[model samples]
Target: MPDITHSIDIVIPSYRLEKDYILRIIRLSKPEKWVFKYYIVVDNPNVIVDEEIARLAASGDITLLINPVNLGASTSRNKGLEAGSGEWILFLDDDIKADERLLHNYVHAITKWPDEIGFIGLVKLPPPPTAFARALIINGSMMIFGIAEEAESFAWGATANTMVKREAVGAIRFSTDYPKSGGGEDVDFFLNVRDSNGGKDYKTLKEAVVYHPWWNEGRPSFKRSFRYGVGNSYLGQFLPKYTYYDFPNTPEALFLMLLAFPIVIFIAPVYLGSWGQLFIGFGLVEVIATLFQAAKRKAPLSAAVAYYVVRLKLAYETGLLWGNIARFRFAGIGARFEYKGRKHGNGFFQFNTYKIVKWVLYALFIYGVFL
Candidate 1:
C-alpha cells in the first residue's frame, strides 16, 4: 500500500444486536491503516457494551454515542456525521462484516473519480435468502436493474454500505417527516443528493463489494408482513415528486390496454385472419415488457410461477398505491402502530384458507381472458 494519511472515519449506526458481530468487523478491518477513527452510534440505552467498545475507546480509535431516545437510522447517521471529524465519513450497517479490502477499495474509488462521484456505495451481495426472505425480496420490489457488462444508464441506489464526503453531507440530511423507524431513508438521501448539487451524478464501483446477512433473525409472521406492506407505501411522501421512471412503458393505465396484445396474437391466426396476427405481435411486445420488469430485479427462472404471476404483480403495485393514499388521507395523531415482541390471537382473520381462496380467485380472473 502507498503512504496514505489516516484521515478517513467510519461510522456504524446500530440498534440492539449481538456484540460479537461488531467486534468481528473491527478486528478484521484492523490492518487497514487508512482509517483515522471509528464511531458506533447507539440509539438504545439498555444495549450492553462489550469488551470491544472498551478496547476501541482505550486505543483512542473508537467512540460510542448513545442517544436519549430511540431514533431511526437516518437521524442516528446524521448525528454521526455531525459529531465526526474527518474529510470523508463512511457509513456501514452494524450487522455487516467489514472485510480487509473494504476501506482500500472505497479510498481508491473516491480518489480516482473524486469530483464526479458524490457518494460511493459498495455493491451489496446478500446471501441466499430464506423462504420468507425470498418471498419478501421478490414481492417487496427493491432490486436494481441492468447488467454490469453493458453499464446501463440507470441509478445505482445507495444501501447501508456507502461512504460520503463530510462536507457534502450537510446538503442531503435525511428527511425527518418519514416514519421514524423503517423504510425509505436511504432512497430519500440519495435523491436529495441528486437534487441539491447542480446536475452531478453518483456512480457505483463493482469492485467495492460487501456481504450482507441473508435473512431476518427468524421467520416473519403475517402481521409483520402486513406492516411491511403498509410501511413501503409510506415511502411515497418523499419519493413521489421525483417520479421514478424506472421502466419504459406508457402510463400504467395505458400499459394494461397494451397487455391485451399478447392474448390477441395467440388467438388471432386460427380464429380470425391475418389481421389477428398483428394483435399477436402486440402480445409478444407485452411479454417482452413483463420480462424487462423481472430482469430489473435479477429475478431467477427457478422463482418463476405460472402465468398468474402478472396478476399478483399488478395487485401488489395497486395495493401499494392505494395504501399510500389511505394513510395520507386518514393519518392523525398517534397514527403509527409500533411492533414489539408481543403475541395477540384474533380469530376473525384466517391465514391458510386466505391464501387458497385468494390464489384461486386470481387464477380464475386470469383464466377469464381465454373465456
Candidate 2:
C-alpha cells in the first residue's frame, strides 16, 4: 500500500546470455497502477534476437536495440538510458527473477526516499550447494543491509537491480575505461551523476528487491573466479576505494603464505605456549566471523558451507595476483595503497568485511610506502 503515481522505464543489457531471461524478467515485472517500458540492448554482434522479440518491439511491447559491436554492459546501458524516456530508469541484469511486487516496491521506495539521489535495491541469490558462493553472498557481497548514508562524491550501487531518477542522472554515463565486467562502472556512473549536481547522492532501498540464479547451476569454476580477480584489478586501477582490496596489496601476502606458513606451524609447538592461549587466539577470528554473519542472517551452519568458502577465498586471492599480470599486459597499472588525501568507498563499511586484517595490513603498507 504505497504511492503508485510514478512510471518506470527499465534498461537491461545482455551479452551472450539467453534471450528467455529478458522475457521472464519482463513478465514478472508488471506492477499494478504504474506504467513500465522495457528496453533490451543486445551486446553481441553476430547473434540476432528471435523474430518474436523484434515483433514485440515493433508492436510496442518492448524496445530492442542490437549493438553492432560487443562494447560490454556499461556501454549498452548508456545506450539504454538514451533510448528511455521516463521519469526514472531501472537497471536489471538478465539473470534476475523479479518479485511480483518488485516494481511496486521500487515505486514505493522512490516516493519514500530522497528524490535527488539514486537507490540500490536488494539482490537475493538462491542458496548454492557450494560453500564458497554461500559464504560469498553472506559474508562478502550484497546480502548485508546495514544503514544508509549520504555519499555524493562516490556511490557503489550495483547495476544488477537499481533505480534512479532520470533528472538526477542527467547527462552522466558509465565509464568505458574499466574491464567490461570488473570495473566499478555501477559506482562510477551513479557517483558521477550524484557528484555532478551539487553533490546529490545515493541511498539504499532494502525493500525494492529481486532474486538471482548466480549459484543455482553449480559452483563457479576456478577460471570464473580468476576472471573476477581480473575484474577486481580493473576496479583498483579505476576506483580508489578498492585500492587496498586489489592485487597491489598481495606481494607480502604471497610472501607470507609461501615462506612463513610452515615456519609459523613449526614454531607453534617449538615456542610451546604452556597454555592453549596461542591456539585460542588463532581460533578466535574464525569463530567471530562465523558468528557475526550467522547472527545477522540467522542461517543454518553446516560442514559443506565451510569447505567451499575456504576454497573460494583462496581462488579469488590467487586471481588478484594473476589479475595484476593481466593488467600489466593491457596497460601498465600499479596499486596506490594510500588514499589518505582522497575519498574511497561509498560508506565506512562498504568494504570487504571478512578481510579487515588485509585492509589494515594494506593500509600500513600504503603509509609505509609513502613515507
How well is each residue in 40-131 modelled by candidate 2, as lDDT tens digits?
88898887677777778899988888899888878899899989888899999877777778777777776666454677777766655566
List pairs with backbone clashes in candidate 2.
Answer: 132-308
lDDT digits (tens) for residues 180-279 of candidate 1: 6555556667656655654354565555555566545425434443334445555444454432222211122334434655675676635344334433
Model 1 scores worst on lDDT over the 10 consecutive residues at 333-342
Q: Against the true structure, whose TM-score is highest?
A: 2
* Top lDDT hit: 2
The reply for model 2, stretches above 4 Å from the true place, is 1-7, 16-19, 28-35, 142-154, 197-201, 241-252, 255-304, 329-371
TM-scores of all candidate predictions against the true structure: 0.63, 0.68
Q: Which residues of candidate 1, in runs, are more than 4 Å off?
A: 1-6, 28-35, 123-129, 136-156, 217-235, 244-327, 330-371
lDDT to native, each model: 0.54, 0.62
